[model samples]
Target: MNDVATPHDSTALVTGANKGIGKETARQLADAGLIVHVGSRDPERGRRAVEEIGGRARLLVLDVTDPESIAAAAHQVGDLDILVNNAGIMAEDAPAPESDLDAFRRTYETNVFGVVAVTNAFLPALRRSPRPRIVNISSGTGSLAWSTDPERAFAFSRGAGAAYRSSKTALNALTVYYAQALESAGFKVNALAPGLRRTDLNERATSADGDPAEAAAGAVRLALLPDDAPTGGFFSWDGTTVPW
Candidate 1:
């Protein structure tokens, strides 16, 4: 394992960091002394967030779904120690028979394809870091084990968000694959179930009372994990393991 430096000199990029959990994760990482890149689709929002997180914070105008944007952003960052894939979209998918295919396509475009694009684009920079960490912001709803439990809300919803949930499940698969492939290279790739935080991801999340900062703290924990820490694992906000 390569443990070369601490957050004091590390650099991190948190996608969709204009607001919500992404923003909080960037803030906390910056507070921990990492040079943080607040990535947002909107330059104005991203700049505003950078200003709010003044210390070692810079704005990165990134549209994860856009190939040009991802490539440009990756080219701009010469080196990176941490990557937090926090940009995701949720759609209110109906039951299997009535669900919209377009919704599924849109959801996968951002939650799954977008992550692959961003990660691959930044691979060169991340490889340059002695201790590289990649944190994927996933949801507990994506857990096949938990979703099957009768007491779980995901089960109760009867596959209401089949598209979004399945996309996360795919993301979990990607996490494991990336970790296995990069283990020898000293990269820690993991997924985080941030819980149902108060964010604008969807109507339910916006009305929810969970603190984005609390969930973001969990993400930061994964981002700065020690060299020997577990990789390709799903963890909750409190640092406990979650079933795949």
Candidate 2:
């Protein structure tokens, strides 16, 4: 009795898909009929996630910070239509003027460098797809416009997490560059802020308002964007454009 025609023979790769927002995104995409590659640094964890997802879900052992791992993953999962750069980390203890330089370096290594590495490694596969899409899981903390405005939501709390915030800002910049470069090829590269949800990344600081699926809404929408969808934009969970 299943009647919905699945969206082509497209495949999606979601990095850090073993848990949290990435996992939710994978589930949504798989439900939408896209073959989803759940990328995790740990193969066991990736396998577990794939098993939990049940259908059209495969494991991809990928450590974004490791060039060899990225290259190997690229080779294994060819012909990708979507790439979700959701792997990121923050030095929870480090903040502001006293933030540890080593911590900042580590954060950048994963958040910034890792993204660029994964994106480049997957470029060939992405280029081959009819409607290539890249979604970077960004945050409001990275919004330069909001962080600087005293009346804005995150302004008061912007003093902390320099490493994480700046890394996402750099990620936003990367999105713009990639979008511009891939425009002629019909690729859509955009950044999305999943909002502060209850997740391991945030140490579950907040209560689960509902389900983790709530946070993945924006990313899911961006991942399955239409041909005419705008590229190089930052959007919130409800689809409102975020200022740079």
Candidate 3:
């Protein structure tokens, strides 16, 4: 990994930042003058994204699924002002109910467990910052109340992906638990649903009028929240609070 000094006193980390909403979040953060670390499992892609952002953007090789990589990235980052848990995977296809449990396990390995690993690993660095924030890139699909609604649009498309949706639900729980634990410690931890952005995760162009940049805005807002902002809450791209 290529290690470099942070250009600003406030540093932010965005996992899966090589592309999609993650990349857009990194770019916007960097543009706003934060020292942004674009985390990617692939070193080449991470470096290229940092270069493209063209500011205080740096590269950190982080594969949330790997413990070694997570630890190494935490050590490399030293101190951080923001942590965006944006890396996640969706199953390639819906598996039979009795089919391989391995597929569901693997999805959780990255979506749920990875968040725990990365957040714990980076806690020390986050605590060091005067204004620390943790934003989990969650989904509207994770909302049991919404996902089960017959009239909800996402419910129609998200019904088949049990592994992915369940993993995110677990992630939402994680966000609240951590937020409570860190509430007195002065860190704002929250989850954000980027809406349906056209990204590789869905294998389709983001729905009409969907912009990854628009989705990233919510994450950026949380990452840059004032010290008095609310914690342990779920929010949407437009800043509306979501049910836990």
Clashing pairs in 2: none
Worst 10 residues of 1 by lDDT: 1-10
Task: For candidate 2, write residues 1-244 as lDDT tens digits.
Answer: 1122236788999999999889999998998888999999999998899999989999999999999999899999868999999999986644578788888989999999999999999999999988888999998889999899999866777478788999999999999999999999999899998887777665543565546687676787888888878889999877888999
Clashing pairs in 3: 198-206
Quick one: how many clashes does candidate 3 have? 1
Off by over 4 Å in 2: 1-6, 204-210
Say what the RMSD of model 3 is: 4.9
Best by lDDT: 1
Whole-model lDDT for model 1 versus the true structure? 0.92
Question: Comparing 2 and 3 by TM-score, which wins?
Answer: 2
Model 3 whole-model lDDT (C-alpha atoms): 0.86
Q: Per-residue lDDT tens digits of candidate 1, residues 56-96?
A: 99999999999999999998998899999999998755766
Please, what is the TM-score per model? 0.96, 0.94, 0.92
Segments in model 1 whose C-alpha atoms lie over 4 Å from true places:
1-5
